[model samples]
Target: MTAENVALVIGASGGIGAAVARRLLDDNRYSTVFCVSRAATPPSALAATPGLRWLPCSGSPEDIAAVRGELGDDVGRLARVVICSGILHAGDKGPEKSLEQLDPAWMQAVFHANSITPMLWLQALAKGLGRKQHCVIAALSARVGSIGDNRLGGWYSYRASKAALNMLLQTAAVELARRAPASKLIAFHPGTTDTALSRPFQGNVAAGKLFSPDFVAGRLLAVMDAATADGTLSYLDWDGQAITW
Candidate 1:
């Protein structure tokens, strides 16, 4: 990618999102960085970055529209789009109870946060990708999302929603191959990080297994930089090891 390329990162208030923003800024590959989040302000570090612009709003239609307005018509083209927005509502031991105890409201909320939000982003920004060159769109996915890898299944809503996100991304990849011809849509597993979302369950993880946000962000950037337009839907660990399915 050129130095003038622009990258949009959703959920910029979170650990992963903030780290990714800093990494991108440090690389100097992108001329402009849009940090979108529901919070009114970005982290101090991100705010201090020269090229970073905070778009403080939720991932709602109105908020995205405001972002679009700020970007205007002459954005040239977007080189990368990263969706880091997600939620981990199901508790530590996985989904608290069996189907009998599951609530529809909770399930729907999980799906909305994990799956539907990404789809909305794609719908809103697909047309903004630069013409006649490969662009990357990556969404953070989990290995637990892989149906074929589900040997120790639990966390029904979280797992299922992430699986649905994977499916949506796969389908979008195929369609973009035919339509855009120069865009790659990918779903990545960022591994377990030492963030609030993963803290509750870190008890089960071996010592030193939890990654820092900086480490995960760097690896994710490396993967995105190396990805090509060819259909490559990978679910991998932090070390780049492919997860089943």
Candidate 2:
């Protein structure tokens, strides 16, 4: 990314998202780093990281549009767009391990957070982001989303929602190819990072297999940096390895 170019990082509140935003700011390559999240303002920690400009957003159409409006003409200078928002659980509800445990309400929440919301951001930003010579829209996805790679079945809603997300991104690549052929769309899995989202599930994750947020963010950036827009969507891991659809 050029010094005059801009970068947008959605869901910059915590975990892997926060790490990526900080990494970008620390890189000092982009002229501006617009960080969006549900918080009323940017976190106190961000003040320590120079070059980060937090733009408060609720992940709504209006908010997304507001963010677009905030960028104004510089929206076209968007070099890299990374959407790191997602939900693994909320309230008392978590992923359903069995079909009987599935609740439509819970499933809907998962889909809304994991899949639909990210699309809304894409929808809002797609037009301005279309002008970049080499832009990449990287959405955080899960390997569990891979229907082909699923040998152990469970986490129905989580799996299905992420699978749906991958499909949406895949379809978006086609549209992006038409509107912005130079841009690339990616469904990126950050691996099992040590975050609240993976806290409960960490028991099964072997030692050294669980990665830190910084590690995952670094790896993801490396992959995105080296990757080219080949007119197709890519489902890849933090290691830059391709995952089956």
lDDT of model 1, residue 230: 79
Task: Kindly report which residue stretches of model 1 are placed more than 4 angstroms away from their true locations once superposed.
Answer: 74-76, 90-94
Per-residue lDDT for 1-245 in model 1, tens only?
A: 67878888899888899999888888777888888898898888687778888888777788777777787642446787789999886453245346675677888888998999888888777666555757788899999898998888668889999999998888887777776777877788888898878877788988787899999999888887777777555565666677776
In candidate 2, stretches whose alpha carbon ends up further than 4 angstroms from where it belongs are: none
Error of 1 at 235 (Å): 3.1
Q: What is the lDDT of candidate 2?
A: 0.87
Candidate 2 lowest-lDDT run of ten: 42-51
Best by TM-score: 2
Residue 52 alpha-carbon offset, candidate 1, angstroms: 0.8
Model 1 lDDT vs. the true structure? 0.80
